[model samples]
Target: MFTPSSALTLEQGWQTTGATGSLQKLKKFNNQDFNHLRTSCLSQGVLFEDATFPAHVSSIGPNLLPEDKLRRIQWKRPTELQRNPYLIMDGVSRFDIMQGEIGDCWLLAAVGSLTLQKKFLENVLPKDQGFQDGYAGIFHFRFWQYGDWVDVVIDDRLPFLNGRYLSVQPRTSNEFWPSLLEKAYAKLRGSYQNLHGGYLSDALVDLTGGVQMAFSLKNPPPDLEEILKAADKSQCLMGCSTSGPLRRNIEVRNGIVQGHAYTVTGAVKICYKNGWKHIIRIWNPWGHGEWKGPWCDDSPQWDHVEPKCREALLRNKDDGEFWMSCENFQEQFSWLYICNNTPTFLDFGDQHCTKWSVDSHISLWSPVLATGRNYSPGAVSMNPQYFFKVPDYDPKPYNIVVSLMQKHAEDMHNAKTLKIGFLITMENSKVLEQFSRTRDITKYFTLSPGTYAVVPATTEDQEFEFLLRIFMKNQDYNENSNFPPSPVLPMDVPRQNQDRSYKAVFLRYTKQDSAIDASQLQQLLNDVILQDEMTSLGGRFSFDSCRGILALMDLNSNGRLTLQEFGRLWRSLTKYMDIFCKEDRNHSGFLDVSELKSAIQTAGLAANEQLLCLMALRYGDAARRIGFSDFVCCMLRLETMTNAFQNLAEGGSQVLMTAMEWLTLVMYT
Candidate 1:
């Protein structure tokens, strides 16, 4: 199985000085160091071959990789036999090293920066050749506030709960190392979580023992290069400098920056047609701050400010105090130091923010019409005939005012006074109360965006529809004048007594004819033909048989055959057969009575012998020669009778009477 013991090794030449101790004592004092060693050994075996790297590792940004060969690394799980037992990597700056969730990032960055400061990397790092080795005499790094650092003795055992050891299976234990590292960093930063709660500046302050500051993305100072160098040199405790006019006030009290602190993390380059622009990356140690500067290319401040504002503001070297960069800088000189950091140009391509708007209307009264001497009982037709068009503006809240008016017809001859009430519907659905008479109608109602109101007047005996007019006016407390004419269209009311002549004519025709017409009769014949064609064995003899038969019968070639045409064809064929053949006594080409009977028997209709006899009698001449017309008529009559009988059997005596009436009409017509 894969193990971490052979994966990473210390630098070739390094040494440690300390007495060896038992693993139990090491576990009691420093479990994190031991866990780190164990994880390293596990990583070696699990990730031995380049192609065996873990999926998560491969998924990291490939462009950021040190070499292309690392891309194809293979990963596997470590077995119990190949585990490691040490804490620190050899030949590295341990003082600056930090661990994140893997708890190593802070330490790593610190040590990485310190290694940049001095080339004595091997002196600070441990001397383990394999995955685990005891770093015996390295002095512990101390935090300024804590005043001292705790001794981190090497150990080989990890923390357990309820006196029970955790399972060392790779699947289960693989996550333990990273989690421990994360916890350590969280504790160092004084934050409980990664994304929230703690201050990022506080972590930096604790780690670096220096004052921290945050800058806005919108209005960053143009002299950022000077400020960043100053920060690196530890010249200013905290600074705020800009190349242009101050966008907002910096609220500092008692010579200290309060609430939160942040530090510059990285730089980004933004490119345009002419050249590239630089933007500094500032992170709030607390992880939250208001940087009222142009964060991205489309920042509004970027549009208003001049290109000179993107340059570094001049600073005074003699006093080392903060300075603001503006046209009136000489007059507003103060004892403060404002430093600008180095500019990092960002390549954030084609990103922008969009804005939209909304509008609304309020109703004066309910739209429901009440029953009275003059008003109708049903629902009032208060459908607004008007639409309110929203203007091109930003979404904001505004109040609407509605007025009510009632008028009575002044006629001495008519005794009753018209007492009409107004009902209103907002946005065509939200109903308001009815107002009977003119009152203080200027009632203010609040509305958001995308709303309109519909108002109508009605009385007790008759429901009258009215247009819902709308108007817009300024919201001023001192102004109490009439509003201007509404820009929206006037409401349209539909008349109740509109003409419907076509409907009346259709109803009259429907009442006159209840029987099936030519169209329906043809449909029934076609349905029967289709059913016969589908069910019979002979129907499958040819693919186009049904289509050919239908076409032949359709005299007009309009893709349909009428019942009259079908009946006529049957009659003509029967008549021709009867006229050409005499009654054949020997049952030859001409069918005699007995030969017809035998034919019926062979066709499985012998049980209806009486019907067969009647058919033969109807079709045959006095000389006993059968005619096609008579034969067709007899067959049609028998089929009609069978249908009538079946309907009667299922529907009882009433259907039987109806069938009789239908048959009589069919035969006579």
Candidate 2:
């Protein structure tokens, strides 16, 4: 359903310096969607449906595609293939790969790397697709694009030479998935030529949406083994590229191809020759070129190895897989890439460890605003910002990890990565201050419990989508970990004007150059109600509700609410408003039992089932309805009791009160 307007919207100027806009947004499709689209096209008597396929996938007249210039190409479906005619046969594995005529070794190497993570591979290559499920001459695959999951569909038509897949294919002849996936990816970009040569790290990120970190094996870190072991535990896909300057094709030395990408399947410490030896297993995407060094297939070193160990690691028959010592690995591989996936939920510490609350935001930075070329005069606020609140319950510091990623920058910019960075700032009620700034995409910081703002930005002017994930480790924090009490008034304001409600009313009255009168207040209330569906005070704030609040705050006993009275009312309800917002999960302007429990717990109070039921029974009507007013009253009393306890604790009182004692104190306080 991509419309003309959608295209124009994508063409809008961001913070870019050139008029050459980004490519058009490709129409997305899923497995089921592609089937439906195919069905519709077939019903319309269309022989070819190129809507989801690349426009210039095949050459016109007698010409051939750039990648297929040498090979005779023919369009065929999976049914025509000989062998296992399933998209995924015998599950996904490194043996499923077969590099074809295309010079996309980097992509194949990444695919091989993905096979190392079983859970992650299932996510990338969903199991919902199958030719026998319902053949419609179409298939789909999902990829992590920018900050979201995008499904790309393609017609079953694939380029073939004789009866074989012309490009990358699986080792099994009938498995057409690898070929089809490569086609869909080529279509994602403008053409297959665009993907000719690229970094395996870039391909890995595109496939998994994981952050890629490159480590130089030349000067290997002392903790290289520990790092790799940790990566394996985290399910990170690992790959290594031979060291050397960029060249078309480096020479193959001792059966190891220089400047070629290889998958690092595992790093293991095994007992060998009456001692322990550190070894690394690597797989070449070509499925050939076995390493001729030690521990290689048919190497004499295997003769001394334990029978079980040799059998477990023996997959030798020219599959391009080999094992070498960790020392040899450091000497052979130049650059190692670790693509680490971010887990949705993360816990820190052991049994007494702190739990973390995680949240993410997807945003974009425009060169349009980066150079102050937009409406604003100064540098535009291209920096994306996020805020998180840490309660002051514990004096111990909390840890936070902030990761910022700019999506598809390498692919879009011709294998050139975008220069992106971020700044995380800590702020208090009184002032804003710098906490830390880092050019690294991922950074970990220790922070005291307070409200902190995180702003992610690019090092230069560029417009691209980015992902910002913040992980805050707390004892047992909830979604409200980032929400702090809103400030409505400052200390410099006069005591009389300190009341936010009164100040708001005076401002409204002054805007019309009038004084507070009944008619003016009534008119304002009417206007507010008409404009807003509901007020923070409650669901459907009626005229009577407004009057009741005004009357309660009218300390001078004035017939009409004055500015000071309104200010006092507003100031008194600030915390209540915050509670209401938190409790109103669906923003229904009311709180149910579950939401009430959440609010109580967030306020640092006991929220057991019995206590919640008792509060609901006491405060709600027969329908169990807790309106905004009821919520405010309950929170006010609770806050008063909590303040008393805090005061006692701060006053050097180590005494602990029982439930009955607490009730008595609350009843009197």
Model 2 misses residue 141 by how many Å? 0.9
Tens digit per residue, CA lDDT, model 1, 402-429:
3332222222211222344334454435
The regions of model 1 sitting more than 4 angstroms off are 1-131, 135-196, 216-222, 229-276, 279-669
lDDT value, residue 358 of candidate 1: 13
Report lDDT (CA) for all predictions: 0.30, 0.58
Off by over 4 Å in 2: 1-32, 38-48, 54-72, 161-164, 244-251, 343-359, 366-402, 407-417, 422-465, 470-537, 540-624, 628-669
Error of 1 at 241 (Å): 19
Model 2, clash count? 12
User: Which one wins on lDDT?
Assistant: 2
